[model samples]
Target chain A: MSNPSPALVRFQTQKSLAHRLTLATLTGRPVHISQIRPSSPTDPGLAPHEISFLRLLEAVTNGSHIEISYTGTTLVYRPGLITGSSPGSGASGGVIRHELPAGCTRGVSYFLVPLCLLAPFSKAPINVLFTGSGVITSATPTGDMSADSVRTAILPLYAQFGISNNIELRILRRSNVGAGGKGGAGEVHLVFGHQVRLPKTVHIMNPGRVKKIRGVAYCTGVSASNNARMIEEARGILNSMTGDTYIFSDVSSAAYLPSKDKSNPNQKRKTGVGFGLSLVAESSTGSLYSADLASPPAGGVPPEDIGRQCAYQLLESVSLGGAVSLAAATTVLTLMAMGSEDVGRLQLGRDVLGSETLICLARDLKAFGASGWGVRDANTGQEGDVVVSVVGRGVGNVGRKIA
Target chain B: MEKARRMHSTQKKYRISDFARLIYDESLAPAEVVRKWRGEDGMADLADDHGPEEAVEEDENFFRKAKHNDDDGNNNEDRLIPKYDYDTLAQKWSNPENLESLRQRFTTANLMKERNG
Candidate 1:
């Protein structure tokens, strides 16, 4: 047979789409661009969302395609070991507007892991007081997400699914009290969050699957009255939740109240009550849910907006972490927020506020700028129910400018 | 020398940390803190030996009020009872002057949360 056709030499090859998916996987050093597409297309941005859909389709059919974005901000560092000085610049902000080529997979390898690692480092505990409500303006480009705005937007979703047997809600009000009496402009921000406890049978795909839930956050501010006498009265009113009394620290330690009672200097201030609410809900996704504001204090300015802003912020914080798999984070955050009692627990008396000085010995302690540290129980490490004194100091070069 | 030794034993240097520890331990305890500059061990010792000078009278008055006359267990228990209960008992021991009816208002608010969970 003609010498068996010289042992007919035929070569065949089978390639897999995993070469594309290699980029999306959380791994060190993404795949090289040349290995997959090996060539740059003339027009990459054609049908943007469709391209993503197609890549996803290819991933599902022929394995998976590594996803990359073209519209991201460009991040560049002067070739050196030193980390760049300004991380705030828009560089490396988002995926660019073009179709992420299979070649960009290599960049993904370098980027994804560090992002996952550093996400926790970006946020430290912050103690803020809501003095009044203000608009949360958008900072970045249109597409760039603003957490504060996202939080404000999601409050309706959470409120609609109110707290139930499976839900536990807690709210914290961070108000910025002013030096002037009540009429002085003060901002009050509300943080509302809830937790929903779920039974084991809900998630059967995996026995160890965690239950999912949602939280709401919002912020609002109101100007206090300038009447000094009323301000003092308001200041004397203790937080209904925590019996702690607050003193008005006027600008320049000046006790002059605009709404001062001419007869009695001590009666110059008015007190304002800041309100916060916590809400939590959990269910198997299609449960009809309903809720309303809990019994609020009778007749003063109702703290309706502050409560909404708080719930909004919490939801945004969770969403930024990830679209799904956010339940564990919500639980941890709820626990952290509820971990301590507010100043509301202490009954105010001059004797209780005795001249007590607390000298804290901080070794290897790190603090964000001006963040107040509560006097926690030394042995148990829980926050003490009472805050007798607060002292903090930091020194910076005279010439340094605060951003 | 014996008086000085006694003074020293009763006195303790007052530091913010020490006061903080005391305050955290119990909010009601009146802790006299005499601020001593760092490295001033001698001053600290002196302050410890002779408790707070300025607040001595105030301390005495407080101690006098806190002084319990008898160590009887029943007396202590009677004193430990809430003031509202004490006022009712004071009118007459075992007096059925409609005293027992007032005790129901002190029901615990968290009874449901603990029970439901």
Candidate 2:
């Protein structure tokens, strides 16, 4: 019932907004971010998608306070209690539904990344229904996160932390930007069961050799033939490296299409339709690395290029030679920093050591009173791998009931 | 116009530091700040030497130091732009020597006996 003290952490510009907000929620400490592109020439402020993200964060947390300057550059956030599914809380079973119309700007992975980190510590189960851009496209351009990448890459990484059984991420519909037709705005549902215990420590020293590669080639409003073409081209490149490669073709039926008939005025309007290719390679040690590409409306990049580019991206990720892909490593590290008081170690590609995402993650961890360190593995040397270790602050789910 | 210009300049003069202090004083809960400060300083040390009262003073000092350092850091530029060089990555992967180095990652290549055994 007593008020928690506030900590002032200042950020110079608009960077890692999601990580900053997520850490503030977990630590229950207010954050003050200033400057926020104060040096930009024109129209400088929080983007519309960032505002939508803030609204989504506010919708989930109870009694959270947010302040912004008139120019929308600086922001001050005081996070409220992270009451998940606790009874008598405003959210029932800690389940909340957020309808994001313009979510296409950032893609669902932007929100999903942080939600995955906070879900295990919620007082109750957390369920979210997101509707917007489902697959990454040129317009949405998977800015370091995408639904396909999250599903194919991140879920397996979470399993190593012992937080796997109750988590579900299902895609109800798929859509792309500027793909006009009957079915557009993608729909995805995520559910997380409450955690009785904090995440377990993990040691991923060697990501065994990749054994097989699998993928999903899906199409909506466009011709289903686009899916087949992508699969053929992608397999052509991957087969040279591994013979056991299978990319399945998936076409959404009319039922998954958004209701656009004038008779049903209240129904959500379809955005557009297109096709996409998502590929994931599984290593013998259960690590997953993934890549994806999507076609825009007619006159965009050719299907062959999309497929070839995706294949090369996968090759790039694999060649980095780590236990997990560069995309999922940040999520795994964030969860490790927020887990129980034990040391967590992971082997990541050398490239990730200098990534902006990792740097922001380190800053966010510091904000949460946790520290993480990365060093080259002595056995393999610099080019081989970078091992990161973090000792969790033992942050408990205060919202959970004592059984 | 002169009055409006004067108002704008005055607002800008307040600076981010002043706004941060205002938010900290008005929004932050006193107890949460101490707990966060102690957590950052390591609870074991706090438990050993000082009581909660002294921890509050330490928290204030931490805030002042944080504010002082905020003005000098120009670390935001690289953080805004992605650092991945895809062209170089493509070139590296295209190299025959590099491809040979990772041949063991595939199923056709022989797996290490210790791993499979």
Q: Which candidate leads in DockQ?
A: 2
Writing each residue's lDDT as its tens digit, candidate 2 over A134-218 gives 3332223434434665777777677788877788888777656543311136677778774645677777777777889998887
For model 1 chain A, where is the 10-residue window of minimal lDDT?
Answer: A74-83
Q: What lDDT tens digits, residue by residue, belong to model 1 across residues A181-288?
A: 111122222222232221111111111111222222222232332223222323222121112322221211112233446777565542222222222322233211
Tens-digit lDDT track of model 2 for B20-55: 232233233332332332233323142256777766
Tell me, by lDDT, which candidate is best: 2
Predicted model with the maximum TM-score: 2
Q: Deviation in angstroms for B88 in model 2?
A: 5.8
Q: What is the lDDT of candidate 2?
A: 0.64
Model 1 is docked with a DockQ of 0.01
Residue B107 in model 1: shift from native, Å? 27
Clashes of each: 86, 16
TM-score (all chains, Cα) for each model: 0.17, 0.75
